[model samples]
Structure formats: C-alpha cells, structure tokens
Target: MPRFGGPEVLELDRHHPDPVPGPDQVVVRVHAASLNHLDLAVREGIPTLKLTLPHILGCDAAGDIAEVGSDVTDVEVGDRVVVNPGVSCGRCEYCLRGEDSECVEYKILGEHLPGTYAEKVAVPARNVLKIPTDMDFPQAAAVPLAFMTAWRMLITRAKVRPGEDVLILGAGSGVSTAAIQVAKLAGCTVFTTSSSDAKLEKAKALGADVLVNYKAMPWSKAIWELTGKRGVDVVVDHVGEATFKDSVRSLRKGGRVVVPGATTGALLELDARYLFWRQLSVLGSTMANQREFEEVMKLVFMGRLKPVVDRVFPLEQARQAHEYLGRGEQFGKVVLAIDTPD
Candidate 1:
C-alpha cells in the first residue's frame, strides 16, 4: 500500500520492479495469493509494526519457481510450489529446535517483508514446498497460513485429542474454517459460534457437531448447556476482547484455549477465578514449523483435510477483495488470481 489507511489506499503497480532472489532464496511467479486479517491490520498500520511505503500485502501464495538462487539444487525453474510465509534465521536456537515461529528474527510474508501480492515474490529456498498435482493454485494458496496456524494451535499447542469437545469461536473466518476441520480430524466433537445462522450451517457442514448463532442466544451458555453443563475440553478463541471471557466460561476444568490471532480487539478482560479454579490453559500459537506444515499439507494432499476458497478475484481487484474480507462476509479464504507475466 502507498500509505496505510482504508482499502482505497491499495493501488495496482504493474511496472513495479521484479524481485531478485537472495543467496538462499528463490523468486516465485505467484499464480495465486490469499488474503488474511493480518493484511488489513498491516494496511491500517499496526502500532508496533513499521513498514516501508508501498509494501505489498499477502501472506499465502502458490506459484511456479521462476528463478532459484545459485546455491539451490533441490528445485528447478517451472516447478509448481506453495510458499511458507514464515521466515526465520536458521541459526537461531528456536530454529535449531524446529520452532521457527519462535526464532529471534522470525517474520511473516506481507508483514515484515515484501509479500506475494504481485507477479513475483522472493522467499527462502527452504520455504517452498511442492503441491499436489491435483490441487489448483487458489486451493494451494489457501493452505499455508490458515491450515498451518490451525494445526499448530490444535495439534501442537492445545494437544487436543479424540472424543474431546473443541469450541472454535467465529464460524466464518479463514482460521476458524480451518480449525473446524482440524479439530474434527483430531476426532474432537467441534462446537462453533457465528452471528449468522447461514454461517453456522456452513460450519456444521465442515464437521462441526454443534453450531450456535450468537445472535440468537448467549454462546457460552449455549455451549455449556449443549455439553450437559460440563463445558468443552478445548476452546479455539482468536476473537480477543469480544469473546475471550465467554470462551473461558465455556471450557471444562483443565481445558485449554488455543489462540492463533486476535481479530476483534487485543485488550482482554476475564475473571481470574475461572482460570485458576478451573486450571484452564490459554496457549498462544503462531504459524506452524516446517514439520507441522508438512504434516498438515500431507493431510490436505491426501484429501483428509481441504482448503475452503470462498471467492476468487483478479489481482487488480484487490481493493474489492480487501473490502469484502474487512466486512467479515467470507466463509473461507478469498484468493487473488495473478496474471502471468509476459
């Protein structure tokens, strides 16, 4: 964006210089890129994040390798691949332990670096993974950030298991859409909340065992009553101040609340008694590590898990896509299809 503000600040720059690959990076000709709430936050200006002018905004991308760094040999030009948005210094202690998200220099595509909204983007060589032959660019692009975040949150941080109840707040968001599937794949009975009954029905179709329209009644009370007053075993709550307290109330004793990102508002308030007395756990998770990424992508490739693409827009209509996403109307990922460069 030229300057951070509303979606109108987004402009199409066809003549922008193509990116050059670093020694350990590869330049990808992005075929498809997907939107995330992070993009909107970055465009509007995050209080803690500083960005250079005219920064691109997209985290997940699927494309072909246009060029590889001199030292790279595992992949070649024209290879179809998906980009892992998380970038970290390999030498860090966290990276050595395979926790790249906790690396000292960890950064995400479209956040701390140039992103994949254009025809070409440069990413680390190790960050590119081959996609299944059957998967389209838009489907592949929708997988990385959303699936990985949900995977790490449920499988790694929360450690959810079979026969448990997982309450995922917000049925229509990209992460929530992915979380419902992930929680189901883990054999958990999923409960999700949305203001719209239509979205609740869609969430139900995604393996949600119980759907509550928050507009119809209080969600926490609904969940509490639905689970026979015992509460859920895990709560996936990224809706910060708006729902955190209720999420706490909806969890069972010794339950876990896994948070990936907060979309509503950050500052949260809750009763401490519920936390300590119930031995509740609130875990924060970011994008997955390489191992977790591969694991979840394997499920995606195997057809056990699927990426939901709500709509497709041409690259030039990014402003419209942003507006659509900002309105919270999409049931899944909104993708931007990039035109092939001549």
Candidate 2:
C-alpha cells in the first residue's frame, strides 16, 4: 500500500519476512489489531507524514512475544503484551521532563513506521505493555490508542472532575466510546450525540447519561436544556468544523473543550467574544505518556474500563474494515483480527 486515497490502496502483498529484532527490540506474533480514525487519515494521506511506499496501517494490537533480541530484558518469549504506538526518544528534553507526548521527535507506530496490521511486527521493548494473563488478544488490542487518547484528553489535559457534566461528540467514534466510560468512572454525567438510534442505545449501555440525536435535535441546544441551561462542565470534541462551534456553545462559563482529533473537517469558525467572555479553555491533546498508558491499561485489565468493540474483520479484509469505519455507523472500535494463532 504505497499509494494513498481510499481503502482500495490497502493491497495485500507477500514480501520478504520482517527482519529480526535489534538489541532492544522483540518480535510479536500478532493476534488482534484495532482501527482508529487516524487510520483513515493515513490511508487518505496527511501533509506531515512522508512515508516509504507499501506501509502497514494498524495502530493497536495485542500479541505474544515470538522472538526477543539479545539485549532485551524484562520480557521473554511467549509473554503476552499490547503495543503502545506512541514512540518518543527517551533522551529528548520533553521525555526527560516526563512529557513524552511532547517530545520533539514523537512518532506513532502505524502512521510514521511499519504497523501491526500484518501477521507479525517488531517493536521496541519500551513500546510494549504487558497484558494480564487472563485477557484475550482482541480485548487487550482495544486498549492502547483509543483509551490512551481519551485518558490524556479527559484526565490530564481537561482535568475532568467528579460529579461534573461532560459531553462527548460523535458517539460512533472509538474515542467517544472511551470518553463516555472514562467520564462515568470520574463520577461525571455524560451526554453524547449520535446520528443513529442504535448507536445511541449502545452509548447508553456504556454509561452515557444523556443521548442527543443530532438528526432530531440541535445538539448544543439539547445539551443546554439537559443541563438546565448551565451547559456541561466539559466537552470532548473531535468532530471538528461541523461541531466545534456547537461544542463551544454547549459548555458552561469557564468550561473546557478537549480535542484529540478533527474528524469532520478541520477549519473551524469561532467568535472571539465568546472565547474571551466565557473564559473558556480549548485544550489540544494527542496520545498519552508512558505513565498514563500504564495507568489506564491497569484499569482495563481490572475491568474498570472496557473497550467497546464494534466489529472484527479478518486481516485480508482491511479494505472492508476501513469502509465500515469510514461510514461512521460503528458504535465502537473496529478491529482487524490476525487469523494466525499465537
């Protein structure tokens, strides 16, 4: 898949085996891989990413260690683990200061480098998180990217407080599903928007306190009424240009809007007066730090946060998986299951 444009670009080709891991790397026998909106962006091609042709396109996975390089320590062959895609040079000043996501050379696994959509992938030992013995590969595969992005945006950047109200835009998105659960865990009331009734039902099952059908109601106005005209304490918005202004209007004075992506088009129009007068904060967050990843995964393992998987497709059906996700009807993560058993 060197080419770009649509899911058709994801062509399957058998090439030479992936090289053996270097000193600090390990090879994983991939079991399950999950999708994200970022996958769509990469498939369509982004301005910042300049990659070699025929790149892989998955960001989240859970697998067993097949081979370990000589210098690898703390992990061994047959160990079960999940891949954490956010990679940063440990020597960078930001990483040194414990802000790894802000590293000058931060890169993600599937986008910038070869990814785990294949049957096997090699990753730095530092980028792998050990999974609990009792968990399944598909469940573990759901944790890394979506949950981490949600955790960083809601907990770290937004500082979502207990008992507050939070609104998550686009209930069909993976991050939105994660946000609903995370917000509920924080003791917050969650409101979510969906274009479909079926998706709204699924969102409610995940602990959403209020559901707004964007087709039936003006979401911002509905949120205002749902909160008794006070609006919510925070809004988790990744819907971009289509919903950004509505997201802003749906917040209370001094409330914050945390954005981790722009799915619905990027260029947004805003009123300067609303931003200044309302004392609003628009926080931008990407992926999570190592500590955050560790913290959130612990919860996932403990069943405190469950990754909602919408569907799983075979690895060869990558194009179909992308098409399903691109349709925006999925209520949770769309995963690609590697048929090979580990």
TM-score versus the correct structure, for each prediction: 0.99, 0.97
Off by over 4 Å in 1: none
Clashing pairs in 2: 2-54
Candidate 2 residue lDDT tens string, 1-342: 779898988987667376589899998889999998899999999987898877887889999998998999889899999999888988988999988899999888789878889878888888887888889898888778999999999999999989999999988788888889999999998999988989999999999998999898788888888888998999998989998999999989999998899998988778889999999999999999999999998889889999888898988899999999998878888888887653
| RMSD from true fold, candidate 1 | 0.8
Candidate 1 at residue 213, lDDT?
88
State which candidate has the highest lDDT: 1
Which lDDT value does model 1 have at 71? 90
Candidate 1 lDDT at 102 equals 93
Per-residue lDDT value at 218 in model 2? 87
TM-score for predicted model 2 compared with the true structure: 0.97
Alpha-carbon lDDT, every model: 0.93, 0.89
Regions more than 4 Å wrong, model 2? none
